[model samples]
Target: MESSSNSKAKPRSEVLKIMEGLAQELYAQIERGEEPVLEIPSRTLSNTVWDPKRRIVVLGPDKLKRRLLDMKESKRFMQTILMLKLIVSSIREGVYPTIRDLYYNGKHTITFRVPNVGAVRENTWDEQAESNAAIEDLEVGLNVLREEMGLSADVKGKVVGPIVVRSKGFEIDATRMGDTALGLPPNPDELDIVKIEASYVLVVEKDAIFQRLNREGYWNRENAILITARGMPDRATRKFVRRLNEDYKLPVYVLTDSDPYGYYIYSVYKSGSIKLSYESERLATPDAKFIGVTTSDIINYKISSDYVIAANERDIKRAEELVRYPWFQSEAWQKEINLFLKMKKKVEIEALSTHGLKFLHDYLLEKIHSGKWIE
Candidate 1:
């Protein structure tokens, strides 16, 4: 099985050599008048296999080759070439550019030639999504992630807790670092842990929850580290959480709103997304438990119906799909999902505010203390 690659990346020289070699091979193929083809793993569920025990989604060996000569592959071929050149240039210059930076860097080159009109500039991706797809293609083609290719994205997560990190050669305690926990740098592949007095780590799905906990000094009282992805987690935040769990052997628990999207967020932390399944094992927090604000919580807490939202067709569809996932095939998870299906209602973490703002704070503490959580 293809396990995930950790953030403790190989030396830049070594990674650069691999990327350069790929570029050279493509160059040699063109020199010989042969159409260059890039073989990348297909990013589909049919091409992915899940390891339930490991809680990781790994890629299969089946590969899809993008050839330059095909009409369908023409745009992708151009995208591949542009991204590959950028990767090589970035590596040669020893600069790690984020996905956004690369999109802008190559935005000008997004031109197509017309038979009568020379080169016509076309507006291709209004955002970085296209650039990201090209990056992933390179990942599967080279059997290395974009990060391993020495590329990263702007950090989009935060942490607030009583843990000290020796990052970039400085000892900083996250707890005493004001309201916002030290924001992780864009490139956290080299973060070194110094000291952690926390008993466990709590990964909140939203920033509001993290801020509330910080305001109440929950971390101080519980002796736990608090982290939030602010929504769906980015690679850096996931890697950082995995590091804390693996390095410190601290129990990691996730808290998310009791909704399909929220559950998916928890799943992203527990098991990496299928889009980036190649790096699942390294980034996924397999041991992290879900200390949820489940549908059951509404009844358990005696929350009023006004606080609950009726599940729409879209919500039900998503929930149904989630239940069929291999990782979610558990007695506890099935029960929770069934409850949602039967009641046709979902609850957000904020619903706890209905009881009282402090109710959520106390509820989380109670669950953690009593060991009430689902896998």
Candidate 2:
């Protein structure tokens, strides 16, 4: 049975001790490139960079003394001993651990004596080994995920600060004084944003397109600088886009593909998560507009044989439903939907030739800069 005093029972002081160990373990896990669990009372205590004083107060000194005393001198029956754990992370302002080599790579294989209730000596090793095994598995999984995602660049380089209490769930962090994420895009109308006379900004989903534009020198040098969503658009991306208007006073043009997946991506960027709609709606990038690969484009531009890739039944159903959705019910969307029902095809941005896309690039640049594209 779960404790009735779950929320209230968690003292602030106990929250600190649980988090300090959690911070150590989480640091170990991330060093191995794993997703560390950030549960409370840790999130409550050490979420935003570690302050040994204020945050750690989640567990009071008295509460920790009681818990520690219960573990130490109580050879007697003190039946209830639940341990709270945390994984505290400090971005740049953390003391780097002096990693001691494991016995059999002991730094990786953590073996410690955890004193729990109803044990012969002080505790049990059976559950200890199992829990330690879980950490090992998590570490290995993180390593594999990094390699698979080609995120070695990020995993090795990305710095985390301290986790703080936001109204929503988790953010990067702020435990120490000076450990902020440098890559964080500025708030709208903040500094470092350059104003462009061009009206439109092209936001792409992949790095390849942005890299290609720079390498090929295809984009309007002064009109549009490319922005990559880095896969999915997040708070960071939305912040950046919101700024193009409020900061740089530029209109936006989003260009992706005519695929069902790309349609969903544009929808999410415009209106936020479809499933988590209520919670995520506010996070949506309200400043951008969609501009390519409509259903009509798929049919008019699509080659039936090559464009008709085997879309899953789910995707087909989603495409149909998307057409009916109020947001995409405009004439441009309706025409696209009708064509989709007929050909059931998709069009990729790649399908647009260098010459063809260059024309679009020029058209979009002209429209944006001329103030004709602003809604």
Candidate 3:
């Protein structure tokens, strides 16, 4: 299967070549009697930088070297090499392995006698996190996505719209999915967007709302694409949204609850989180706007006090952090966040049901047509 139309993942042949090159470099180091070292861009928080120009978080120029000769780094260096071997094998054998599968495939115990001590045991990797970290190192070092390397992961995104996508030589039209939405593939980058006839894309935070809108023919009525990742979006969903915004120039609107968590989710879709800044260029849609169930909505839409939930300490803390983010510094966002803080209250998207089940349709229409959204 090929990568998505706009994905930066290298072709399979190129991915294989890159992996081969990496292995050859290590082999050459061994032949030359030099300590083999792998230089990877650091994924630390300190290395994550905000690119004002791009309006996205990105990795700064910081590198970490894992040297085989160093006692502290030796284990990680070996793990990286092991992961590279497993990934290369998978690519050549035409087998797709999930991250969990890779972890189990590489997990093993080693027992050896110490010079003056009894036998000691060590595991290749005790947890999936270690193997996942190794995979990420390979991804960043090789400049190729894991999806390009034939790795798979759980996909949570679903879509329904006036669009057509091709996966593995099979065409799937989003508009004709009946009562069900098209489930996004594990690697959305591999799905080729065949055709798009939508004016805009509406991204919902809740799956139930997406289903509600789809079943109610929201996309049909508005001539738009609708998508949801259930909650905080996965990488495939984020990348797909980015493609729609960047490749198709579709105006993307995010609808979420009025809480800090919801605001953070929208931020992830727009500017991306600092933890995964390296993937921001491909996954983040900087132009995406928030069509929220904002704190103001509680007052503006006459949402009953019974439906408004009081914010907890966690919500307060998250709101404070959001206020300081570079992207959230806009006057509109500041007002919304500050309002939420002052009100010490939050409301769910379903709170709109207080008016009527069909009120959500009108709310969405007003948000889009009246240009009532925060970027």
Candidate 4:
């Protein structure tokens, strides 16, 4: 499907202008006999910092200088330039290409001979990782999201709620989708959120649970929007949740299993992940709450011991790492992680079914209404 003409025009012009500016800088440098360089913010773990005030991870003040004349940086510089050209060409041609499509489009072998050395062959990029890195570099360097450049990625989020959104000139009402849901687009920012009539947003970690709640009409009764990314969330899901909270002032409550992995999912939604800290400003929902299946619930809710799973070494290690995150330093989170470590036991949200299948609805209402969630 085509994007709405009005929405497409602005992003196309804006991104092209930014790309043009980068090209102009390089051309002027070459004309003056100076080596051209691109200074992009360093996207290293060491350069990712937690902002205490903003309550989110952000890229630190370190920059990498990619100089065309430097041997070590030349290939990466070339890759970035090639990606820029490909993206610019796509924008001009009005064709949206996925990252994988760009990777194959740009992949080719170059051969050249050196003194006393036979012909040497090198690939433009050995793998998708290399190509994706270049795309990310362009994102940081140009201060533009790949979505703005008409790039697409696999979208994995779906929602059912009292929300109405307009995408590509088509209006979608989540409440009217019946057993299905409104599939989130790759770029949620491009969606025109026309209306929201929900008291809160319920973000379920597992798609099955999301489906159960949707099918049971849990959202309709609670006046909530139900969303799920299936597992670890993608940028579109995170961004869409952030918009719901930031723009519409809806409280976001994440429901996950009572384990380290589940906690980490909530962390990614609320505080942003370490690797993609640069996107936190647009993606993280600082006010999102963790509402369920906490380690303590295992005992409080009288979940059957048979439903409990012993915390594996990996789970313990992940919980330890989470304790060190700045956002997880809250008193409630501290207590929860410490308890998980001490008990070395975990439980799933389905364990609540020990009471009844419909008990999940009661549990959700209890958490939100009683203010029994951790930040």
Candidate 5:
């Protein structure tokens, strides 16, 4: 065996962290209208890792065990350059942005990058789950720094909002902007009660839901903004929620399904999602909540006629246990949970449309005339 200790290649983690920080400095230097003194190191394509698919060296210097050890710490970091190459290459070749967002199901994963500022923030980031930490933190940090050079997460944060694809075969989102529409007195930051207008809002989870309501003429009549997250809630959704809280003076009422996926959806909305753009975390983390999918709705609808989703044992157990959780004990959540338990079947807002034109008119009328519908 040869002595592979004299390798100069930085560990994937170290290299990524180093390059990312440099990239940001280079980026910031440019932003400050100064010439960027960037010296992107010339890392030899030493095959430290293997790649059967590309039939090429995923890592350099196949004999360099030292670099291999660095890779062991973070597989995604080592793959950053490769990931960037693939992404930029794809972009240059005109892959659709939405398609790019969904690109990591095969050889990689899509992740978002966020950076942690100051020294102590490292510990704060480390506390997050490992997989989440990698894709959402360090990897995200590196990617976002590069992305931030062009765009922003929000006007205030100056953080880069990018969907990253990790070489470790994954994806992440790194952004930190809240909806400006959900709060009172017309502004969330200012918290002005005077700007408060409506008492509640109904947030649907899908565009199909919104479109159905609109087609049925519920949108204009209901007088409540019927917006869809179009799947997972994005920055736009957060801002909308915030605006509801700040500007609209409306109690934002989420209307999602009774499934685990829906529960996670609600969680992401209220709390901030994880940031995955750093090696050891050089960024921020956000958390959100899911206030809808009340078990009570499942119970109230009388699951006798057209109600039947075989609840997995896990689903049954979770829905039962969720009711006991303190947060769900709020008057509304409690009521919703009870409804779900009683029926033993969930009522997706989408289902209401099956009742056709009558359901839309009734649901919206109920919403507008009664504050309870939203609250």
Candidate 6:
């Protein structure tokens, strides 16, 4: 039960140096006829602490030992070593690979043979999910993101705005792209925001809403950048939104359904998710405002009750849990969560269709101008 103050994380170069140091230490141990022991942070949730001040989850220095002599531990040790070699070697060669690429490329080296019996065994990392989990474990141990290690996930999400980007030997003017919105690049590390001439940033929960806005030329009319993560925002989308706020100094507003899940989506952008909370400092946008389709909006807009969906058991449970979380305990947020629980109902942004196809568009402009948002 110790804090993360024991040690600080390092940059990518230092991470590579630490891996090399570990490898060298193991080599020295073998040369001295001793068993090599690898010490790494335990990725167990019990060992993870949510730091309220920093607003991110961090690992304690509760190191677990893996010795080369143990049979069960040896299999994991071998897998870790192989993966480490792949990562470090790839970085050295200036080649970045996705987790899936690394899995297929390194899966063959993971096969093992039984002593004396000669039975060939395989699957140290049986599937891509296993490899992905291992990568997360490595991140927790190293206290750095995989992207920093010259690795990236398949990109998700799309953006359209008066923003210009220069990266990977190409320049793009998003506003001049006409109707086609830009798909977020896989390697966002190279993307340099050349210019952002938007009044504010709008982050929507659903792609359908994003498309509706885009098709109606909402960004053109409002002079705002529009973005969507499809459903749950990925690291790339979150980071991009953060940049729109931090780099461009634009106010960011989230538009989501009047449901618990939508609330959680807003929370993810503002406070970061629990799983990837270690990188919250870079991912979370604490300044983002929640401009929502709230419970009162249904009544205020006079949407018929027929379009309203009953809140399922799971929705209520999630809202209850979120209301107790430290990050969602603010008076405004608490009231919203409480109202949803009290009403026991939910409504999507699509319900704005009751008035017209473009009602939601007008709603956004009105909300922004009137400063009707919850932080």
TM-score of structure candidate 3: 0.94
TM-score, each model?
A: 0.84, 0.47, 0.94, 0.93, 0.44, 0.83
lDDT of each: 0.81, 0.42, 0.91, 0.89, 0.40, 0.78
- Please list the residue runs of candidate 6 whose C-alpha ends up more than 4 Å from where it truly belongs after superposition: 1-39, 60-73, 92-96, 108-123, 127-129
- In candidate 4 the C-alpha lDDT for residue 361 amounts to 86
Evaluated with lDDT, which candidate comes out highest?
A: 3
Measured with C-alpha atoms, the lDDT of residue 22 in candidate 6 is: 68
Off by over 4 Å in 3: 1-5, 112-120
Predict model 6's lDDT versus the native.
0.78
lDDT tens digits, residue span 1-375, model 3: 223356544668889999999999999999999989999999999999999889999899999999998999999999999999999999899899999999999999999899889899999999999999999999899888887887888788999999998888999999999998899886776777888889999999999999999999999999999999999998889988998888788999999998999999999999888778888877899999999988899989999899999999999999999999989989999999999999999999999998998999999999999999988
What CA RMSD would candidate 2 show?
15.4
Model 2 quality (TM-score): 0.47
Q: Identify the candidate with maximal TM-score.
A: 3
After superposing candidate 1, which stretches have Cα over 4 Å from the reference?
1-7, 27-37, 66-78, 94-96, 107-130, 148-152, 354-357
Clashing pairs in 3: 4-189
Give per-residue CA lDDT, model 5, range 1-375, as digits (tens): 211222112333444445456447646866998644422222233322323332212223222111213535334333333344433443345442222232342144435445653332121122223323233232233433322211112221111121111222332221212322121111112121222223345566765665565555443344444446666665434543544443334555555676645654554444332221111111111212244444454434443347546556676676676565433445865666566556556556656556563664565455446543422
Q: Cα RMSD (Å) per model?
A: 4.2, 15.4, 2.3, 3.3, 18.2, 5.4
Estimate the lDDT of model 4. Answer: 0.89
User: How many residue pairs clash in each candidate at the backbone level?
Assistant: 0, 33, 1, 0, 92, 0
lDDT of 1 by residue, 35-87 (tens): 99887888877888887667789887788888889998877777877888898
Q: List the residue pairs that clash in candidate 6.
A: none
For residues 1-375, write the lDDT of model 2, one tens digit per residue: 111121111222343344455457657866987644432111112222312222111221221111213445232112111111111221122322111111112212223455773433433223444333323222222221111111112211111121121212323232222422224421211223222344346766655665565445434354454566655665445544554544444556666666667777776666554433321222345556676655565444444555445556776898888776545655766766667767676666666563365655554455355543221
TM-score winner, 2 or 4 = 4
